[model samples]
Target: MEQEANKKRKIIHIDMDAFYASVEQRDHPEYRGKPVIVGGSPNSRGVVATASYEARKFGVRSAMSSRRAVQLCPDGIFVYPRFDVYKDVSRHIREIFSRYTDLIEPLSLDEAYLDVSVDKQGIGSAIEIARLIKQAIKDELRLTASAGVSINKFVAKIASDMNKPDGLTFIGPSQITGFMEQLPVEKFHGVGKVTAEKMKKMGLHTGADLKRLSENEIKQYFGKPGAFYYRIVRGIDEREVQPHRETKSAGAEDTFPVDLTEIETLNKELERIGALVATRLKRHNLKGRTITLKIKYSDFKQITRNQSLPFATDDLEVIVKTAQQLLAAVDHEEKAIRLLGISLSNFGEVIAIHGNSTQLSLFD
Candidate 1:
């Protein structure tokens, strides 16, 4: 019965095209069709939040440095992000989604996944539901959106990105295998650049190549995530569309422009990151008992250390001091640090009560 229910699940992934840049273009007629880059100034240490399609042609991308974006597209127009306006637009689109289904899980301000298996409008066809949602956004919001329809979230997400600015793609179960088999390994979800390169070196350039490996072989090569790849490559993803998902961890990390070898500079960076985490925890009215410090060397080697506190806290001092302690225990003098991160986890509500005790450990 559970298997039957899973077979009937209908999912849709909706993604706005160049959300920030599109909004800018829509609001100002002069910016339309021009290369608009929304982020901090090129002279500053800011990253590109979003780039218009015109700018994308010049190789500008999100998370890329604003200075690099300018170097790529010298004619690009840079504008500071107006998050207030973007949030308003996000709310409006979510309202539009509510008319069709209440089981909507927003990934960010620009994208979301909707389970339309049991839509409020009594719509039985998932494809039709997606079409209606996209058309509604076009009519009411005067903005275009791309959508993907499938039996599960993974396929739906990949399908949505198949076509560009305004696209609606539906992948039935029968079509899933062929679609996935031909897909480049790098295009698979969770396969980062490093993982993709590893796959290629192992002669697993595409899903078809990955399918040749047994589950045990994949597990031997990739660890726990290999189990996930094993299933997804065979068109099997049992994960559900969770609408009210709670964040299990809150943290911040920064990739420094230059590698730092000194402990003092590293501590200052950790302090800044710890404070950011504390502020987020307070804003969410949540306290965490575990503090984790993550470090990545210039050579891309990474390590994490975690410590559990006697009491849940959102205190900046506690977070900073705890992270600093964790940092002190690690042997950082051997390698220059390229990135540092601090995260608070094991939230108050979910953490196991240990009779008020603190535990500290080093994790490799």
Candidate 2:
């Protein structure tokens, strides 16, 4: 029954290619076929949010420093982000998803997971639904989106990235295991650069290599995420497409032009960030019991410290004082602080479901 249920579940992952850069290119015809980068200025201590395919050819990538991006793609065009416009476009894209299924889980403005086991249009084939959706975005939004169709979210997400702009990939149930076995450990969703390197150092380079370890052994090595690696190696992912994923936290941060070592400077910056967090919480009418402070050193090593208050708060004074206290406790006498952030979480509220709720198929 479990195997049958897994086989019957139809999942699709949709990801827009270079969403921010693509949108800029679509709106500005002159940017077509050119290296367009959307983010802070190259001269600033800002990072690249997105880079066009042309820019990527020069090795410029998202999250890379804008200064490095400029060095890589000297002729790249830099444009500030237009989030409002992107959000509007995202709404249109979600509307397109709604035409086929209401079981849509938006991972971000540029990507989403869709459950079409029982599509609204009664289009039984998940592959066909993906193709049509891709075509619709191209025709109506003048943008390209890649899609992947499979039995579950994990495989579907990996498949979606396998193809490039305007591509669609369909991985059937029978192909899942073989595909996973051959996959590099680095390709797993939660495995970051450090984890991948550690895995490779341990002679575990692929899913097949990981499969050689017992679940307990993997857990002992990788901690909590090891159990996930164990199951995903065999293509066993039963996670659902949740339409109303909760907003885990709200926060803001800033990257400094020059790293600072002074306690006074750090305290002032934390005050500013705390005020921003307070404003955001009040804007959304949210009060969180836990306050977290993220610190990034000059060498790019990062750490986080959090304190849970006896009560939830959205007050600027409370937020600022708490963040300052957290910063005060960190022993950073020699380390230069390059970035500081504050966020509030643990909202004591029921998670609300979005969309027009629909009945799941018998398979679900």
Give Cα-based local distance difference scores for all models. Answer: 0.82, 0.84
Q: Which stretches of candidate 1 lie over 4 Å from their true place?
A: 1-5, 250-291, 296-302, 305-329, 333-364
* Per-prediction TM-score to the true structure, in the order listed: 0.79, 0.77
Candidate 2's C-alpha runs over 4 A off are 250-291, 294-304, 307-325, 331-364
lDDT tens digits, residue span 1-364, model 1: 5335556999999999998899999999999999999875787545677899999999999767677789999999998766567777888999999998889898767899999989998978888988888898888877889999998899999999999789999888888889889999999998877678889999999999999999999999998889989888888888898898777898878888799988899887876576556534533446788999999999989999999999887666778889999989987668999989989888867322122122110000
Q: How many backbone clashes does candidate 2 have?
A: 0
lDDT by residue for model 2 (1-364), tens:
5556778899999999999899999999999999999876887644566789999999998766677889999999999766557777888999999999999998777899999999999989999999999999999999999999999999999999998878899999899888998999999998977689899999999999999999999999999999999988888888989999887798888788799998888887776566556544533446788999999999988999999999876666677788889888888859999889999999977222122021000001
Residue pairs whose backbone atoms clash in candidate 2: none
- Clash pairs (backbone) in predicted model 1: none
What's model 2's overall lDDT? 0.84
> For model 2, what is the alpha-carbon lDDT of residue 171?
90
What's the lDDT for residue 118 in model 1?
Answer: 91
Give residue 130's error in model 1 in angstroms.
1.0
